[model samples]
Target: MKAPAISYWSLQLLLGWINFAMTAPMIYLYLGLPLVMRQQGWSGTAIGLFQLAGLPAVLKFVLAAPVDRWARDTAGYRRWSLVLLVGYAASLVALAGLDIGKTGFTTLFALAMLASLFGTWADAPVNALAIRCLPETERMRAGTIRSAASSLGAVFGGGAMLILHDRVGWSWPFFVLGVGLLLALVGLYLIRPVHLDTIATPKRSEVGVRQWVGYFASAQRRRWVVVLMLYFPFIGTAWVYLKPLLLDQGLPSGQVAVVAGLLGGVVGALGSLLGGYVTYRRGLHYALPGFAMLALVALAALSAALASHASLPLLTACTVLLALAMGASAGLVFGMMMYYTREGLTAVDYGLQSSLFVLTRTVVPMLAGLLLDHFGYLGMLSALMAGMLGIGYWSLRFVRGMGEMPPKMGRVA
Candidate 1:
């Protein structure tokens, strides 16, 4: 018998908590740890090497294959999630037991790397379970919730954890996060197992490295991939360099952190939720082109501001516009990722697309940095603006070709 549908908001709440839990330790590793290390007078090289902890995220596609092969049903995915979440939480608790000041940097680094590995590996099954269980109608909202949860995680990991560390010490931050993860694990159990038609019987022969190549084999998927590649990176690059641009414009570092870091994150979260609502109301045909156009305008405005050496007020306005665009675009993009995921191969497909997404997101910033050095802010921003304009036009044409907005959920195009 088909399992009864789970409550939509309850599912989102559980998934959002998982997203938040997975995200926090990563934020701590990337943002919080560096600050503490720097304060401890760690060498620049050592601090730089700490970034290696995130390497596992780049290999998410590889990590996902095992889950796809082994976890053939919603129940199996849930089991994997439970086991992985346990490891993730335990890693944090283990880290809490060690003293950063006394523990060798190597030991601390290894533990953090282990935490990242578990977190990255765990995400695949959690998302696969989400994809399987969530009705097509709720997919966009799932994306919104995921995006918002990630932002809140950033605030907790990057901001609050740092404060906790200062007030109580390093151990407390990890201990607090560890306890939170355990609580999330308990909540995970409260969610009754759901079975969906989308969960296919395991076909061991079809599951392998070829699954990665098969993802892009469809013409419709290829067109969708084009949209995915083009959608977010330009605006993402701009956001990456926004802080330095503000500082160059004479904003104090503290003020810059408030405006760019704190304010930008909060605005991005609200924008994500609002974007999901807009997509729900207007549909993907409208939301896709609408967000692309908004992004184009925001990029143009930011470039013009930079070129003219605009005042802080004008710049701040542009910053808010760009952040909103970024957040909205992120929601739509994430939703589409879920949209494109193949039913039987949920984990591997999502992992492959996500790997591509991360690769471009990472590469663009480096290229943008080069542009910034050679052509300055105006040049870099203008270049991104031009890219967005082209991508935006292409997206409009592509959506027209799709024939309807938000293709019937879970029907393979």
Candidate 2:
């Protein structure tokens, strides 16, 4: 029951806050923008199409080699994180100036995509830093901390911002977000250099995408990669569509933000923190499937509410449960991803896994919009529940096949 050495523990707290900041822009774009645009008479399809702006985040893996390569000689991940934070904050300020009501979709889309690009660049190094800093034993707890940070970010970005926009307008939320990012930038000064030799040291020669992929191509390694790619798509899609579904249920915008955005985010954050503690104590082999099953049960509860045309209050409760499930499951999966990431190439490998994770979260929502058009919210939820069951089944089976490895490999990458 020894705590992580003080140094590694401090690194975890620092990384956790950086993730909170990095998560804000995305939450604002996904949660806030959709609500604002929908209130402005934009169509469901248009709101969903805006998800394309998030494509840069998915493509961030393309930059992973460059980030890792560039950092080798300079200040390491710390430098990359600082540069991207400033750029992302500046982009958020610039975004504030756009009059979305008067602006063309192309222009707004481009700006959002640009902000996301900056955010994505900032995220790669944070992942690398975490992978480099934590020992195998600490990753689950770190994942939970990171997840809690993300949940708080969502509460601010998605919940608080939406309510602010409802009370104020478009520009102030962006201004606040820009200021938050700048404040998070100050935290960079707190991160001291970490030296963990236990992590694999990459030769200067083996630093490219080819080498990164070659490592993943081995028979034993490929299965882990597949697990990363497919694990969270269903729950992710559910999260994206939940806000809109609440709107359709006749919940006031402010109430929806309070229920789904603020209160739900708190529950989700707590769930993530709890998931991390449980995984750390009992091991991921026991925790992963348990979390996945809990997520499925939450989804079932949500689906039933949708089907029954439940009261707004009842729906609100279901939203909280679903958020809790999604947050916990995500924390567990993220911990597993971190555990599996190869040592020296942490950025590239983690980026690749995240790229696939973002791909599903981003793509499925557009399809959900289509389903909503044809079938309504109830139909859409039902379809998502079925997919969640199917995917959860396979993932649980995959968890069983994840045979033992060396201590480092057993952690996953």
Candidate 3:
């Protein structure tokens, strides 16, 4: 019997819910945990080292190999997702049993690291499943959904979790997050698995090293890889440092939190959705160039505002523009990544691109910090603006023929 076709919106919502569930706990670990540790009188060094718990995310490509090797069909991918998500939820529930106030740092850190590892590993199968199930026409919407879900996750994980801890206690936050994850798991179970084309089973000889590295075996793939690395990181680095800039400009900490944390997240989410709609209405050729232009304008405005030490309202406007640019660019870049993923090796290809995406996003901030130290805010902004302009030009030229490329069924080699 033929299964009922799932509507596009239904699939996006389910995928977005899964993304939200996966993201919130990690955000809590990264954002909420540090604040708690600081309040508990933990040393700055210890708290700094706690950030290492997130290192698992950067190794997604390596972690994805097993899923690609084993989960060669939609049903197999769903099973892998269930097992990994169980590990993720179980880790959170376990954390709920540990009292952070009296627990040893090593114990808490180890548990948190395990949670991150499970969450990171689980993302591969989830995304591969999205690629498998989503039609080519709806891929951009899927990216927008991810961006919006991530923003909501940040608010819940970074903001709501901290508030819960403040009003209740440490364990409640963990408990609540675990419950949320399990709810998403229930939702996943309720949705009937949709079978698309089956991936060809790899021969034993083709299952090892070549499968891992085959994503980079072609020139066109390499070009897209460069675009993946460069396109969004410049704007992203600026967004990362925006809060510090506001503080330096004499905005109160409370105001900075509201502006950068809450307001920025909402605006960014809206921007992501809008960008996706535009991309869907026009073509990638039109959407990519338009988004690149928007980013450049935002960067220029931000630079000008910083250079002049503009009024509070003006500064806020500039911040909103930059946030929107960052969000819009992310929407486009994610869709592009999906567009570039190979058919048979969806997991491996998506993992490699995502690894590079995350790696560059991580490293560029350190370099940006150095630039800020050496050249001040104005200089750093100028450097970023120039870099964006250059990269934008190159990306447009490189992707000029992206419309000509097949949206579905990319060649493995």
TM-scores for all candidates: the values are 0.93, 0.86, 0.94
User: In candidate 2, residue 346 scores what lDDT?
Assistant: 71
> How do the residues 265-352 of candidate 2 rate in per-residue lDDT, one tens digit apiece?
8998998988887766666566767777777888888888877889987887888788878888888778777766665667777788
Candidate 1 lDDT, tens digit per residue, 156-238? 88888998999998789888888878877887787665433444555554677677888878888899888888799999899
Best by TM-score: 3
Order of the predicted models by TM-score, top scorer first: 3, 1, 2
Clashing pairs in 1: none
Q: Flag regions of model 3 displaced more than 4 Å.
A: 1-6, 195-205, 406-413
Which sequence of candidate numbers ranks them by lDDT, best first? 1, 3, 2
Off by over 4 Å in 1: 1-6, 194-205, 404-406, 409-413
Best by lDDT: 1
CA lDDT, every model vs. true structure: 0.83, 0.76, 0.82
Model 3 is weakest, by summed lDDT over 10 consecutive residues, at 404-413
lDDT of 2: 0.76
